[model samples]
Structure formats: structure tokens, C-alpha cells
Target: MTQLETAMAILMKVFDQYAAADGKTSSLSKAEVKTLLEKELPQLIKQAKNKEDVDKLIKSLDFNGDAEVDFEEFVVLVAALTCSCHGRQGKK
Candidate 1:
């Protein structure tokens, strides 16, 4: 798969995890993201009450401003908060 596809998949995975656990992942689309925010993340999602906001988010993390979040950017945004340690590789 191309880098774009990988990025989309990762985004979908993160979206699904949070949506399912904390919100709703049934849609997984822009609308769904808004819904997830309204239903789950009331605080931050409040800032993104519509698809346009979601698109803005996608653009913000898109880095190159390609209007699309590629794998590299997606990895940076989604993976930054994850992983207990950055340099450590072995299991905890």
C-alpha cells in the first residue's frame, strides 16, 4: 500500500479505538468524527462541532498542507502521545 493508504488506515484505527471506547465509531467518516466529539470528547470536540472543523484538523496535521494527512504526519500526530517510551524498544 502507498503511504497515503497507510496513513488513512492508522487514522481509522485511532479513530475507531477512541470512538468505540470513548465515543462512537460506527461511522468513521467526517460526520462520525463530529459525532464522536459531540458524544465523547465534549471538551475538545466542542471546538469541532462540524465537518469543516474536522477537515481543518486534517489539514492542520497534514504538515505539507497537502489537505490530506499522510502517514508521516499521521504517525507524528497519532503516535506522539502513544508509546510509553520513545527510544525504548523492548517490552515493558
Candidate 2:
């Protein structure tokens, strides 16, 4: 697979791995999201000034007002973070 395809596959796999924690494969619960971030995105979590920042991030990712985050919402978070990081790279 191409690099982009591999990345996409990895994203799906990671989401599925975390989302399955509560026997729900379609979405991620708040706790699952937190664990995913803590374990998968440790750098981002470390950059968070406090727990509230992480809480706010998880809340914001829930676009449908549902307590859980679906795959679309998860992709948006990843895309936004990618854009932010890419923009920073351009500046450097």
C-alpha cells in the first residue's frame, strides 16, 4: 500500500482498537478517547497544560452532541492536528 493508504489503515485500526474497549465498535466512549489520547498521542497529552485541556478537547471532538465520538469526529481531530502540525513545519 502507498504511504497514505497505510496511514489511513493505521488510523482505522487504532480507532477500532480503542473503540472496542466497551464492546462498542462504532464509537469511542469518553474513557476510551482519553485512553487513546494518553496512549496514542502522548506528546499531545503532555503538551496539554492541565486535565481540563484534554477534557475540553474530548468534548469538542463530539460534534453531534453525543457523549461518544464517532469515526468522522475522530478523523476531524486527526486532520485538524495534522494541519496544525504541517503549518508549524512550514513556519520552521
Candidate 3:
């Protein structure tokens, strides 16, 4: 997949699984996304206008926001930003 795909995957994975206190069964609520943005990806999540923006970002990455993303999703978003910080790079 491409870098955009990787990043989307990461965001989706976090929202779909890791972001939730209850585990991977639901999406991150708007408030939770804001908190995470303030902490984890302060820059990206900061620009988010509203739930719509979050939904857009999420769907853009998921390409449909099917509910979950995997490691590949992470790569797409990070790669899109050219963060190059994640050790995984891509794949797996």
C-alpha cells in the first residue's frame, strides 16, 4: 500500500482498537480524539474542526472507515505526513 494508506490505517487502528479504554470494539468519540491529539499526535488532531473532520480524516484513511485499521494503516498516515519516526516504516 501507499504512505497515505499506511497513515489512515494507523489512525483507524488507534480509534478502532487502541484508543478505546474498553478495547477494540468501538471508535474513538470526538472528545477522546481531541485528548489523544493533544497528547499523541498534537499537530494533526489539533487542526481537526469537529467530528466531521475527524470522520473525514478517519474515512479518508480507511477509505470507508469500515471500523478498524491494522499496522498497514499506521504506515499510510505517518508516511503521508513523512513523519518517518515510526520504526515500522511499512508492511506488517
Candidate 4:
């Protein structure tokens, strides 16, 4: 697979792995999202000013107000972070 394809696959796999924690394969619950961030995005969690910031992130990511993050919502978080990092790199 191409690099982008591989990255996409990895993203799906990671989301599935975390989302399955509560026997729910379709979306991630709040706890699952928190655990995923703590384990997979440690640096991002570390950079958060406080727990409330992370809570705000989780709330913002739930665009549909469903209280759970499905694949599309998860992708938005990843894409936003990727773009933010890419922008920083370009500035450097």
C-alpha cells in the first residue's frame, strides 16, 4: 500500500482497537476517547493546559451531539492535528 493508504489503515485499526473497549465497535465513548488520547497521543495530552481543555476537545469533536465519536468525527480530530503539525513544520 502507499504511505497514505497505510496511514489510513492504521487510523482505522487504532480507532477500532480503542472503540472496542466497551463492546462497541461503531463509536468511541468518552472513556474510550480519553484512554485513546492518553495512550496514543500522550504528547498532545501532555500539552493540554488542564483536564478541562481535554474535556472541551472531546465536546468539540462531537459535532453531531451524539455523545459518542464515530469514525468520521475521529478523522476530523486526526486531520486537524495533522494540519496543525504540518503548519508548524512549514513555519520552522
Candidate 5:
């Protein structure tokens, strides 16, 4: 696979790995999201001022009003974070 294909596959795999934690196998529960952030993106979690802020961040990512994050919504969050990080790197 090309780099982009590999990246997309990795994204799906990661989402599935976390999303499966709650037996949902499709969407990520809030707890699963928190665990993902804390384990996979510790810096992002650490930057938050407190647990409430982290909760709010996760809540904000739930765009479908379902109280859980589907793969599409998770991709949006990942893409946004990727863009944010890329932009920061460009500024340096």
C-alpha cells in the first residue's frame, strides 16, 4: 500500500481497537475515548488544565449528538489534530 493508504488503514485499525473496548465494535464510548486520549495522545490530555476540560474536549468531538464517537467523527478529530500539529510545525 501507498503511504496514504497505509495511513488510512492504520486509522481504521486504531479506531477499531479502541472502539471494541466497550463491546460496541462500532462507536467509541466516552470512557473509551478518554482511555484512547490518555494512552495514545498523552500530550494532548496533559495539555488540558483538568479532567473537566478533557471531558469537554471529548464531548465537543461528538458531532452526531449520540454521546459516542463513530469512525467518521473520530477521523474528523484526528484530521483536525493532524492539521493543527502540521501548522505548528510549519511555524517553527
Candidate 6:
């Protein structure tokens, strides 16, 4: 697969890996999102200036107000994070 394809696959796999905790394959609950962040994104979590930032971030990602993040929502989070990271790297 191409690099973008591989990245997309990895995203799905990671989301699935975390989403399985709640027995729902379609979306992630608050607890699942917390776990995914704490486990898969320890570094980013650490970068958060305050603990509430994590909660706020998750809340913001729930664009549909469904209280769960679907695959499309997850992709938006990933894309935003990627853009933020890319922007930071370009500064150095």
C-alpha cells in the first residue's frame, strides 16, 4: 500500500483497537477516548498544559453532540493533530 493508504489503515486499526473496549465498533465513548489518549498518545497528553485540556479537547471533537466519536470524527482529530504537529515542526 502507499504511504497514505498505510496511514489510513493504521488509523482504522488503532481506532478499532481502542473502540473494542466498549463492544461498539462504530464509535468511541468518553472512557474509551480517555483510554485511547492515555495509552496511544501519552506524549501528547503530557504536552497538554492542564488536565482539563484533555476533556475539553474530547468534548470539542464530538461535533455531532452524540457524546461519542465516530470514525469521521476520529479522522478530524487525527488530521488536526497532524496539522498542529506539522506546523510545530516547520517552526524549528
Deviating ranges (above 4 Å) for candidate 1: 1-47, 80-92
lDDT of 3 at 13: 66
Residues 1-92, candidate 6: write the lDDT tens digits.
99999998999999998889889989999999999999988998999999799999999989999999999999998988887877863454
Residues 1-92 of candidate 3 have per-residue lDDT tens digits of 89979966666666555446546444444445445556778767667777678767655655445554444554566566664465555546
Kindly give the stretch of ten consecutive residues in candidate 2 with the minimal lDDT sum.
Answer: 83-92
Ordered by TM-score, highest first, the candidates read: 2, 4, 5, 6, 3, 1
Model 3 poorest 10 in a row by lDDT: 24-33
Give me the runs in candidate 2 sitting further than 4 Å from their true place.
Answer: 88-92
What TM-score would each prediction reach against the true structure?
A: 0.34, 0.93, 0.47, 0.93, 0.91, 0.90
Stronger candidate by TM-score (4 vs 6): 4
Segments in model 3 whose C-alpha atoms lie over 4 Å from true places = 1-38, 83-92
lDDT of each: 0.54, 0.97, 0.58, 0.96, 0.92, 0.92
Clashes (N, CA, C under 3 Å) per candidate: 0, 0, 15, 0, 0, 0
Query: What's the lDDT of the predicted structure labeled candidate 6?
Result: 0.92
Off by over 4 Å in 5: 88-92
Considering summed lDDT, which 10 consecutive residues are worst modelled in model 4? 83-92
lDDT of 2 at 43: 98
Candidate 2 per-residue C-alpha lDDT over 4-67 given as tens digits, one digit per residue, 9 for 90 to 100: 9999999999999999999999999999999999999999999999999999999999999989
lDDT of 5: 0.92
Put down candidate 5 lDDT per residue, 1-92, tens digits, no spaces: 99999999999999999999989988999999999999999999889998899999899999979999999999998988998988863454
